[model samples]
Target: MNWEQALGSKAELINTALDLLLPRASAYPSPIHEAMRYSTLAGGKRLRGAFVIAVADILGTDGERVLPAAAALEMIHTYSLIHDDLPAMDDDDYRRGKPTCHKVYGEAVAILAGDALLTLAFCTLSRLQEKGFEPGVVLRVIQEVGKAAGSQGLIGGQAVDLDSEGVKVSKETLEYIHNHKTGALFSASVRCGALLSGAGDEELQALSEYAKGFGLAFQITDDLLDLTGDQELLGKKPGSDLAKNKATFPGILGIGEAIKLAEDQVKKCQLSIARFGPRADFLRGAANYLLTRKR
Candidate 1:
């Protein structure tokens, strides 16, 4: 599928949508706008947005109909990364190959930038209704996305991750951390696409399974990357995950075992989409890409 090329195209679509949804650069005469722009435009793979758009494509819907929600998901994801790299969290010095927001804009500004991006996410979604999508579907997307990004989902996972750092934890606890911290957003992205496309309950369930598997697989691959990826390749240091004492798949299982686990999850994700036939190709492709990702 030439995943590198495909991923580039997907990333372009996501960036375009984000540009369309961003508040006007001069909307508020504030420095926070620059900070927000710095963080948002620093650039990542935009995998979450790609997943949302791909799911919409699978449902035979146009990307335009789902672009706002997809961009919103990217904004939320970017906000999480911003907060996660704070001095209180990972204390990361660099992100996406550039100095972090706090490093460039100061801590207070960085925090406000994260807050602005987060609130902007909902604002983007709220505008979707004006784009002519079904009102009921838009409402459902908002609700699902809110819950996923809230205390019960990403935030909860982050809490668990913070508490578990440097503490011995069971495999189950590790699962909880990864599922909540990483899986919830994945679940939301897929669910949002399904809801937007009017997918039935059965299809939604299948997509949810696919997302869960992808979530875990994504984290596992990220851990693997931290172990083996070059700083230049990853836009961050290798072995940072272990150096930070972050809980990770490799921390729980040896690297060999972690790779096996990731492979298994990829299979599970592919199986989840089997019933959808050719329409599920992108989902399958995405799962495979996760397994093979170096950065």
Candidate 2:
């Protein structure tokens, strides 16, 4: 499949897995469950899940073998988004063209919903052992995902980002926020997929480089979107960073420089995967797409 088609197919699979794994909306204490389903099941690119699936495909790994971890990645990403949109965080009203979880469920329940998702992500990974993945491999997946979502990774980046708001930060600090807050989980997703497929040291190294470059490009583009994206297409108000006085690449570097930085990162990502040839075309296309995406 082409990149777009592959993305859609992977997203469908992820949604199906998420629905099967999560509690029904009608279950006891349904409000939280409903909120979880509302935000997660809402349409998205499912970019993190798709990234995992795509990496697995390059090695001909069974899709089912990676599905559990891929689902976990999606859950983690959704959880982060839900929390990030809370009043204590970015305070967003909408996401993916729909009301955000907190907006529909109230802050208390939304917070609980995000907490549930974060807890569920690890549970989701534990299921990999049931699918015949070795205990050692499953443990590694847990470690990778946990580290990416925890203090040393996503949360740490978010803390730095919070502190950087309304202040002039160095380019290095801005990159740190982008890398940890956004890039860490992305790198984890790619690494998890590669690990599940039993990739060699060489392939893993290349993918690691690719992941780093792609993740940075992803954040840079996201920051740019806050300045240049259409609100309708973005599914939320633009200038959110400006409104919050969040430190962003464009705030630290000019728009032109930020755009150029993303372009450079995309080029490096594509090159890192070049050895995979046509098998890596979708990834190359995906990296390029992130560099130039409008939303």
Candidate 3:
């Protein structure tokens, strides 16, 4: 299959796993569950989840063996989005072409929904043991995901991002925000699959480097899209970054320079896994796909 077709298949697999893992909307305390489903089931690229599956595939494991990890990563991603759209956060009204979780469910329910999803992500990770993975491997995956989502990773990056808004920050600071906020989970997603598939330390390290470059490139392209993309294509209004006075690649480095940097990162991402030869073609395609993505 081609890249888009492959990505779509992975997304479908993840969506199916998520549908099974999440509580039904009719379950007790339905509002929060409903809210969680509302944002998550609403469509997006599912890139992080796909990364988990793709890495597992490249490492000679059946992608289905890591479905729980893929689903858990997507859940964590959705939870982050829900929280990121809150009034005190980015204050976004729309995401994935629909009203954001907070707008649809009210702030209280939205907050609880994000919390529930985050908790459920760990719960999902723990189930890997039941799926015949080693307890130690499962535990490592859980810890990796927790650290990525916790104060030292996503949260820390967000704190710095919030603090840096509308300020003249150094490129070093901006890189820190992107690496931690966006790149940490990306790295973890890659690592989870590698850890599950019994990849060697060198292999894991190479994939981590690939993810770092891919994540930065993805963020740069996203920033560019926010500046120049159409709302219909983006699934949300453009220029939200500008409105928030957020630090962005284009903002710091000029549009042409930012594009060049994104291209450089994509090349680095490709080279990082070149040692794997054709086994890693999908990942190289995925990194290239970042540049051309409209949403």
Leading candidate by lDDT: 3
Q: Write the per-residue lDDT of candidate 2 for residues 1-295, one digit (tens) a residue.
A: 4678878888899999999999999998999899989988988888888888889989888877789999998999999999999989999999999999988989999999999999998999999998898999999989999999999999999999999888999999988988899999999999999999999999999999999998999999999999999998999999999999999888888999999999999999988998999998878888978865878
Q: Candidate 1 residues 34-102, lDDT tens each?
A: 788778877888878877888888888887778888889999998998899899988998888888889
Q: Name model 3 segments beyond 4 Å from true.
A: none
Q: What is candidate 3's lDDT per residue for 74-182, written digit by digit as tens? A: 9999999999999999999999999999999899999999999999999999999877999999999999999999989999999999999899898899999999899
RMSD of each: 1.3, 0.9, 0.7
Q: For model 2, what is the C-alpha lDDT against the true structure?
A: 0.91
Candidate 2 residue pairs that clash: none
- Superposed model 1: Cα runs more than 4 Å off: 24-27
Question: Comparing 1 and 2 by lDDT, which wins?
Answer: 2
Model 3: how far residue 35 lies from native, Å? 0.4
lDDT at 211, model 3: 92
Q: Ranking by TM-score, best first?
A: 3, 2, 1
- TM for candidate 3 is 0.99
Better of 2 and 3 by lDDT: 3
